[model samples]
Target: MKKLKNVLMVALIVLSIVAIAGCKNDDGNETTNDNKEVNNSVDSNDDKNNDDNDKSDTDNSDNAQEDDLSGLVSVSGSTSVEKIGIATAEEFMALNPDVTVTYESIGSSNGVKNAKDGVTIFGTASRNLKTEEKNWGLTETVIAHDGVAVITHPSNSANELTKEQVQAIYKGEITNWKDVGGEDEEIVVVSREDGSGTRGAFEEIVEFEDSLTKDAIIAKGNGNVQTTVAKNEKAIGYVSFTYINDTVKPFKIDGVEPTAENVVNGDYSISRPFLVIYKEENMTKESKAFLEFVLSDEGQMIVEEKGGIKVN
Candidate 1:
C-alpha cells in the first residue's frame, strides 16, 4: 500500500509540472503578439508625426516666399532722405515680391512720433532721436550719412556764404541777399517745418535756437524746400545734398562744398546720420530679414546709387 501511494504521488508531480510549462508557453505567445501590436502602432504614429512635421516645414518655406510678406510695410518721415528711402523701397519690393513697402515723405519729427505710436513699421530720420524717444519703444538703425547744403535760387549768383552769414540769415538777423553780396532782394527764407530732423540739425549746428524764433516760410520737406527755393528768385533754403541739382545752387560753407566725397571724408561741416527706427517688441522675421538686406553691402550700394551716402 505504501508503494502504491509513492507511484500516485510521482504521477501527480509530473502532471503539475506539465500544466505549469503549458501555462508559461501560452503566456509567452500572448506577450509576443502584444509586443508586435505595440511596435506596429508606435511605428505608424511616428511616421504620421514625421509627415506632419515635414508638411509644416514646407508650408513655412512657401509662406516666407509668399503669404508672410504679402502686406504693406508703412514707412514715413525724414523728408531730408525721402529719395533714398523711396529708391530702396522700390528695389526691396522687387526682391521680396511678396512685400509692398510704402514710404511717406513726412518730416523727421513726425516720423519718429509715428514710429513711436506704432503707426508705421519704420521711420526715417536725418538726425538721431532725442533722449525722450526711447520711452516710445523705438530703436534706431543708421542707414546713411548726409550733408546739408545751403541752397539759393539759380538767379542768385552768390556762390557761398560763411557759416556765420548762413546762420544769421536763418536767424532773421540778415534779411537782405544784398547784405551777403547776392542781390538787392529781401532774402525769402524757406525753412523746413518745426518737427523736421533737418531743421533740428540746422539749428544745432549754427547755434540758432535763440534767434530762429522769427517767422520764416515753413516748407514741409526737403523736396518742398528745394521747390520753394527753386521757384522763388529771392529764396534761400537749406537742403540735403541728394536733392541738389541744376535748379538750385548749393552755397559753399566756410569754403567747403557739400559733395558726397566731402561728406564721406568728414570735410563737410553739416553732416548727419540718416536713421530708420523700428519697435523692439513688434519685430517680425520679415522685418528682420528686410532690415538685414538693407544693412547688407547690396543695400548700401543701392543707397549710393540713389545719390545718398552709404553708412556701411
Candidate 2:
C-alpha cells in the first residue's frame, strides 16, 4: 500500500509540471503575436509620419522658391526711380538668372495712368499720388528718396546758393550767373516741360508758374536737361540726383549739400520719395512680391548703393 501511494504522488507531480510548461508556451506565443502586431503598427505610423514630413518640407521649399521671379517684369513711369529700378532689377536678375526686367522712363503721370489701366505691371513716380489718382485704383509704394539737384556746366563755380536766390534764378528774377556769385555771363535756365514730376517739384518749390518767359528753357527729360546744361556754360538746370555725378556738380541749397545722408536726415528739403504705383484691382502675387522686395532691407541697400536714399 505504501509503494502504490508513493508512485501515485510521483505521477501527480509529473502531470503538474507538464501542465505548467504547456501554459507557459501558450503565454509565450500570445506575447510574440502581440509584439508582432505592435511592431507592425509602429512601422505603419512611422512611415505615415515620414511621408507627411517629406511633403511638408517639399511644400515649404516650393514656396520659398516661388518668390523667385523667373519671367519678364515690366517697369515704367518715373525717371526719378529709373536708376533705382534699373539697379534693383539688375541685381534681382543676377540672382533669378532667368528673369528679365524691361523699364520705360515715361513721365510719372503717364506711368500712373498706364498702371491704372493695366498697361504695365509697375510704375515709378517722384511725387506723391493725387486724390484723383487714388480714384483710379492706384496704390503708391515708397521705393527710395531722390533729391532734386541744381546742375550747371563744370565751368560754373557757383557751388552754393540760398533758396531765395535759386528761386529767383528759376523765376527769371536773377538772369545772370554773376548776380549770384559767378561769371558775368547771362544765365540760361533749362527746365523740364509740363507733366514732368521733376519740373513740377521744382516749380512748386520755387513757386514758378507754367509757360515761363525767355529766361528759362524747358527741356523734355532730366537727361536732356543735363545735356543742355553741361553743354552750355551759361546754363543752369534742376535734375534728379542720379544725373548729377561727374557730368554735373549739384549745387548746395542754402549751403546744405543734397546727399543721401542729408535727405534721410531731412536736411535736404528738395528731396522727394521715389514711388511705385500699382492698380489695386489688378494686383497679383508677382506684383506684391516685387513691391515687397523693393521695400525690403536688401532693396534699400540697392537704392543706397545706386545713389538713392535708403527709405526702408
Find the candidate with the highest lDDT and give its number: 1
- The lDDT per prediction is 0.85, 0.81
lDDT of 1 by residue, 1-312 (tens): 999999999999999999999999999999999999999999999999999999999999987666566667788898877887888788888888878888898788888888888888888888878888877778899988888899998889788899899888988889988898887888888887788899888888877865673668988878889999999999989987788889999998889988989988877888889999988776666677677877889889988887789887
In candidate 1 the C-alpha lDDT for residue 164 amounts to 93
What TM-score would every model get versus the actual structure? 0.76, 0.79
Deviation in angstroms for 83 in model 2?
0.9
Q: What's every prediction's RMSD, in angstroms?
A: 7.8, 5.1
Ten contiguous residues with the weakest lDDT in model 2? 206-215
